[model samples]
Target: MLKVCHMTSVHKRYDGRILKKECVSLVNAGYDVTLIVTDNKEDEIYRGVKITSIDFHPKNRLDRILNSKKRMLKKALNIDADVYHFHDPELIPVGIILHNKGKKVIYDSHEDFVQDIKEKVWIPNCIRIVLSFLFKYYEKISAKNFDMIITVTPHIVDKFLNYHRNVHMITNYPVVNFEDRKNNKRSDCNQICFTGLISPLWEHENIIKALNIMKKDDISYTLAGPSDEDYIKKLKDLDVNKRIKYMGVVDAIGVDIIQTHSVAGMAILKYSQTVGGKIGTLGNTKIFEYMYSQIPVICSDFVLWKEIIDKWKCGICVNPNDIDSISKAITFLKNNKLEAKTMGENGRRAVIQEYNWETQEKKLLALYAQIAGERVL
Candidate 1:
């Protein structure tokens, strides 16, 4: 039997879309899979996938910085597997070591690290720039050492195409039939909802600003996700606090509940130099969830998003950085109830037709087949 070892260096749980779908698919394909993750302690199983957590010394900054790589290298060396698949960039060095030992290694690039580094406020800009350069250099060199390269977006594929000849695009789409919940009637009030990590780049401020412009007491905004203390404080300081409702980090079911009561889903990401570069070609997860819930969407006018929204006629697209534009889009959706419903239906149809995971799964399995040298099914 073929065995595959998957690695991610930092995750509290093994529940994200990419990990979950990949685990399920690999197990069904008859591969004995082992997933290595990092947390406080070692665990045995996560949603039926075998998991091994490492015990490392020095939980502090410098210790963690030095030890994480060492622990991952040790874990990779010990695992008895036919192939080592690395999902996170931090494990690139481990991949290198495994390749030196004549092992097949797969590097999965989930995001564009060069662009993503700009959004990290904790790091000084100078350091971020230097680190970004070094990361790209190492990524190009290390990626070539891998037998296969998997990425979540075409843009990411383009980044490594010059370095690695065997590159595959495996997008992070939702699991098929996971959000088949029927659409119930929205609340009597006009409800707008936003989901995902609450951060400055997400541009919750623009949403609040748009709400304030509406000045309609009948509309309510639902902010669903974990918030940074600073960002939460900033939201509270907004003049439209009374119109906002905070529903902390929620599961898929919670999202369904919120969407059932919401008229439209908000995807108002701002075009910061940092965010613009990182998210330009990426599809946000919430957009599809919103479609699955059959709610109209108001998204930023990013090039990729515009192609999707325009092609599907799913919802309105506006400049997220412009308060007036966002407000106008919201108000239009609110006033034209029938149009909103139609747009929501169109989005659902689009997802069911093309964007759903069932369609993406074939590509995923094909990549695995190419790697394992046999058809997965």
Candidate 2:
């Protein structure tokens, strides 16, 4: 087995994409995999992958970005794995150093960092633009040194094609098991669930407002994920009827239970120039997760998402910013139970046939095989 090490100065040790998807997949493919993350917890083996933490928990975002990369680099060098796959852009320098030392390097681009930087609310607008521009050039230059570039979406891949020839698109699709395929009993037919980042970007206030517009007392909303106190307060204020159930930071099983029990899953996001709008691609993991969980999705009417829902006959796509439009979609799904069930079935079929993680896993394994100069079976 070829030894591989994946490092991240940022992101949790068990981040869904990094550990649950990438590292775990590699381990299952017979690779000796080790994941390095910045945490205060002791290192251990889980799901057959070695997880080593650097013990430098960040006091703030800046500490992680500015200081953790150096510590990650030192630790990565000591491991001396054949391939070093890094997830964070802050660790780009670390990837370059490993490449210079004759080890294969892979840079996994989870998002359009250039576009993402523009939406950093903490950063001043003027500085954000300059940093985006500089980072664009920096990323372009650094990408050429890597053995492979793994990206999440098509638009992100287009951004890297100019700088590297070995770029590949491997999405973060949900890994559905045999049990997930069987229909689980819904805990509440009128319950709507939203999992993932619970921020303004997801348009949660509007979602709650839409629920109010429906005027259905039984139609409750469940939100699970991390959020700030201020944001939680803002949401609570809007949820005057106390219909919203907030589950702060749930595990994978918790997310599964919420989705399986809900009548519909929500991914209605707000778009803006700073956030570069929707990438109009299959990058949103929530939509796929909702589908795989056998629940219909109520999401933004972006062209790509609209097309998928239309073709799969899976869910309703609505204008996320319009309260009435969102309310109408929710109402239709709630009032029509049989149709909603069929839509959920269609969505899961689409995922099983085309959009599941198995397809992406093949691409990932092939990329690793190319790096190792071995043929993939």
Candidate 3:
């Protein structure tokens, strides 16, 4: 079997995109896949992929950026795999070194890191642009040395094509099997749902404010994801009625259960051009997740998302920051239950037809085969 080693210093061992989708697909395709991650757990085989733990988890952001990648590089070199696939931008140096040594190196650009750097709250506003420019230059130069570049969206691919000749877009779509979570049990449900990273990046406060604007005693909103205490407190203070429940760090099955009881799924992100606000720039996976769960969606009115909503009629697209717009959308879905159900079915059909991991998996395997210069399986 072809040997493949995937590495990441920031994401968890079983990150949805990395392990559940990419590594698992490679393993099933008959590749000897191994993942190196920054976890404390013992190395073990999970889903036919070897899990090698770094054990020394970084203490903070600085520690991770400065040291974690170094440890990851050490472990990667020891593996001596045929292909080195890395997931984080900080691993660019590692990828460069591997490429210099004539190893097949693939950099998976999960998002537009240059654009993402501008939105990072931790970075000083004055230096954010300068850092973005410098990194953009660095990434452009380094990317050419890699054998292949994999990106998530077409926008990202277009951006990277300016950097490297070999760029492929493989979206982070939900697995088709998630359609199994849907049922006829949500007819009388009055809850709105969101399950993913809960931070300032998304308009969580707007959702709570919209619920307040509705002033309906029966309706409730529930969200589950990893978040900080200060932000969570801020949301709790805004939610005086306790209608919003935060289930901290829910697993996949937990997400299924939450979506199973929800009337509509919320992906109302804050609008900003620098932070994935443009059309075709962002492929918000939650929209597809909600579709697969058979729930109507209430997401941002970005052109990228609006096109999908317009085509599929899966849910409502509103200016996420506008309280009245969001409230009106909630009311429409709640009052017209049959229409909402039909919208949910339309979304599910859309996913079954195109927006799915199975479709992306074929592309990923084809890319790998090209990189390896032979059929992967």
Candidates 1 and 2 compared by TM-score, better number:
2
Give the alpha carbon lDDT tens digit for every residue of 1-377 in model 3: 68999999888998889999999999999999999998678999989999998788788888889888778888998998999999999999999998888789999988778888887888898799999999999998898888889988777888888868889888888888743645546777888988998987778888888888676585888889988999999998998578888899898889988987888999887776553564634455888989888889998888888899999999999987689999899889888889999998999889988899999999999988887774242
User: Model 2 segments beyond 4 Å from truth?
Assistant: 179-181, 185-188, 216-218, 251-253, 272-278, 374-377
Comparing 1 with 3 on TM-score, the higher-scoring candidate is 3
Error of 3 at 110 (Å): 0.8
- TM-scores for every candidate against the unseen true structure: 0.92, 0.94, 0.94
Off by over 4 Å in 1: 56-63, 178-181, 187-189, 272-279, 374-377
lDDT of 1 by residue, 163-254 (tens): 78898877666665744656666536467898888877678887888788776685888888888887787787894647888899998789
Poorest 10 consecutive residues by lDDT, candidate 3: 273-282
Clashing pairs in 2: none
Candidate 2 structure quality by residue, lDDT tens digits, 1-377: 68999998888998888999999999999999999999999999989999999889999998888889888988999898999999989999999999999889999988888988888889999999999999999999988889889988777887789879989999878887755446766634768999888888889999888878666585999999988989988998988678889999998889988888888999887775422465465666889988988899999887778888999999999887899988888888888888888999999899898888889999999888888883222
lDDT of each: 0.77, 0.86, 0.86
Candidate 3 versus truth, CA RMSD in Å, comes to 2.1
Q: What TM-score would you give candidate 2 relative to the actual structure?
A: 0.94
46: Cα error in model 3, Å: 1.1
